[model samples]
Target chain A: MRKLKAVKITQAIVELVKRANFSLRKDVLFALRKAYGFEKNRRAKTILKAILDNAAYAQKENLAICQDTGMPVVFVQLGQDLKISGNLKAAINSGIESGYKKYSLRNSICKDPLLRGKSGFSPCIIHMDIVSGNKITLTLLPKGFGCENKSQLKMFKPTSSLEEIKSFIIDAVKSAGADACPPYVIGVGIGGSADYASLLAKKALLKKIKLQRGLSPKGTVPGLERELLFEINNLNIGPLGLGGRATALAVNIQTYPTHIAGLPVAVNISCHALRSAEIVL
Target chain B: MKRIYTPLDLNKIKSLKAGQEVFLSGTIYTARDQAHKRLVQAIKSRQTLPFELRDAVIYYCGPTQTPQGKVIGSCGPTTSSRMDAFSGFILAQGLRGMIGKGSRGLGVKEAIKKYKGIYFITYAGCGALLSKYVKSVKKVAYGDLGPEAILKLEVENFPLIVAIDVNGGSVYG
Candidate 1:
């Protein structure tokens, strides 16, 4: 079995956190530029330009794209044949603590949900998967509360029509208004159990931003992604919900097979920043 | 773009219309949910506010830490809707303007009309660019809240759009 040092993992996590916060991915930048071109409202155009400029400033000055560095959501794909030498969770949390402190990132985590107190940015949330390989892959998605708070999951009977599903997404996005930050990305997960469906939706957000908009991965309903994108943009929420043509940049969907009795759907939204980074070890 | 100075008076805010682009300059206070709660509590308990509320522009932001040898960190508008409930209370205290991102609730709109207030929306997710406008920042109150502490910020040419006018007109509509 291949042996991987936990310190190396911790180092990777630390670097990933910095990269994710400071840099806007190329695909995401391209999408923002594309939205700027397609957006008709002059106000929306100005806001998009500011967003693009902000991204450039972040990259140049080594500053976080947004003050809300966000909670570290780490996705780890561990090799089945590899042995981790140190405590995995401990290493992950240690990296987050050190990186956040060293970079002066905001500490947004609370001690508990109801009774809010400082958690010192410890206990990083991590999702792990075992795959057939010798290399471990880690993707860090720093999810801000603005977009995360607006995500929703709904379980409908299998008999629900496609139109019903479509409206559900539309209403959710419309109601979210500028709160979730418009001209954002939408990740949809369909057909899994409640929790699994939401997880899939969140995972879908980490996928590459394609040149083509609303392109779902395999096994999803064909063309549904594109159709939803059109409907959502037509809502006229625009950039920052100030009213315009570019409410959503893209809508990506991932689906899984589920029991016949029920269909679970989850919608995860991401702000225009869409900060994410990955590393392979 | 039109330019507006801080410590905005009711007359000046009332002249602004929804969707008008404006560059704001002068002093502003920074506060998010936690500081807002305390502000309201102070008012209800008949205690002095952390800052003078009359004609003040409150920014809905929680900036990252000021790095070594820096005046401030990346600072951007947070979601405005989260503070919708407390907006009316603050407005009633004689606030002239607010800067944030996103839409406001109907209650906030009504209060804006009743109190003749302005809701300014800045570029969302553009903290780095926005920080360029902030000349200086000093913690004024609630340091225990960390990033959510109330701050006195001196800004120059801070870009914003009037999302809600004193007449209750909203850009989101």
Candidate 2:
């Protein structure tokens, strides 16, 4: 068994947190910039421009791209052949605590939710996946409150159709309105138990920005992603839903086989400032 | 329709049109759930407010830390509806405007119409990208709330859109 160095993992995580807070992914940035060119609404164009400018300002000043630096969500992809030499959870949390403290990131975690009292450090929201390779992949997403507030999961009749799936996404966005932020990225998981659906939905947001083999180009991704994107954006929810044109930037869906009696779905919305990063060790 | 700033009066707010984009400027207040509740409670009890509430624009934000000697952290709008139940009383107390993201409750719309106030929506999740507009900041009250405290900030050309007008026109459902 290959020995894993706790020192390397911890150090990399701390750096990941800092880097993720200050930077938006290049692919996402390019998408936003391109969206500006395609968006015909004048207000939307200006809004997109402002979003681009904000990205620049965030980078130049070494500041979080959004005021809500969010809870440090960590995704660990471990190798089945390797060994983690130390307390993995503790090290990740330590990295989170140190990252927040070092970067002056806001401590958004609370004791019981209802804003009763403060929870000093954000607990690491971690998910571990064992893969066949010998490397460990760590990804960080500082999920802000706005997007998190709008996340939803529902179990439907096993016979539900595509329209019903559409309703769940629409309702989730309408209720979320400008709260979850607009020109958002929606992650949807269908056909799992509620929690599992939500888990997969969250994981969907961490996937590569490009369409892949999992969703066949012609029949799967472009078909569903564009169709849903068209409808959601046309909701006229627009930038901030103060009304314009661009509402949702994209919708990514992933489904799992589930019990025959029900169809479960979850939506995890990612706001315009989708700040996340990943690295393999 | 135009975006106005804090320390403003009802007259300026009333002049704003529905569905107009306003560029916010001047001083603004930071207050979330806790601070809002406290402000409303103080009003009922005839207690002194941390700051005066006349034609003032309250920003719904909880900023991050600025370790490198700065006035404030990443200050952006929180969910507006979270402060919905408390908005009526605050509006009746001569408040002119509220800035946040998302839809406000029906009560808030009614109150806005009754009191001739407006709700403004800023870009959500654009906090780090929006803090550049802050020229100065003053910690007024509720420091204990950590990021949820009441702060006074001076902004220039802060971006916003009028979501609910004095006439009760809602941009979002």
Top TM-score: which candidate number?
Answer: 1
User: Can you give the lDDT of residue A237 in candidate 1?
Assistant: 85
| A1-281 per-residue lDDT for model 1 (tens digits) | 99999999999889988899999988899999999998888878988998899999988887889998888899999999889998988998889888888888888888788988653666678999999989999999999989999999999989998889999988879778888777879989998799999999999888776666446564345477778888898988888887788898888888899999999999999998898899999
Candidate 2: residue A49 lDDT (0-100): 86
Quality of model 1 by C-alpha lDDT = 0.88
Q: Write the per-residue lDDT of candidate 2 for residues A1-281, one digit (tens) a residue.
A: 78787867888888998889888888778778767877888877887888888888878787888888887789999999888888888888888888888988888788677646855666779988889878899999888877888899888989887788887888898877767778888888877898889988887787656532244354464577667776887787777675566787678888889998989999999998888988888
Q: What root-mean-square deviation over C-alphas does model 2 reach?
A: 2.5
- Best model number under lDDT: 1
Classified by CAPRI criteria, candidate 1 counts as high
Scoring model 1 with DockQ, what do you get?
0.80
By summed lDDT, the worst window of 10 consecutive residues in model 1 chain B runs over B10-19
Best by DockQ: 1
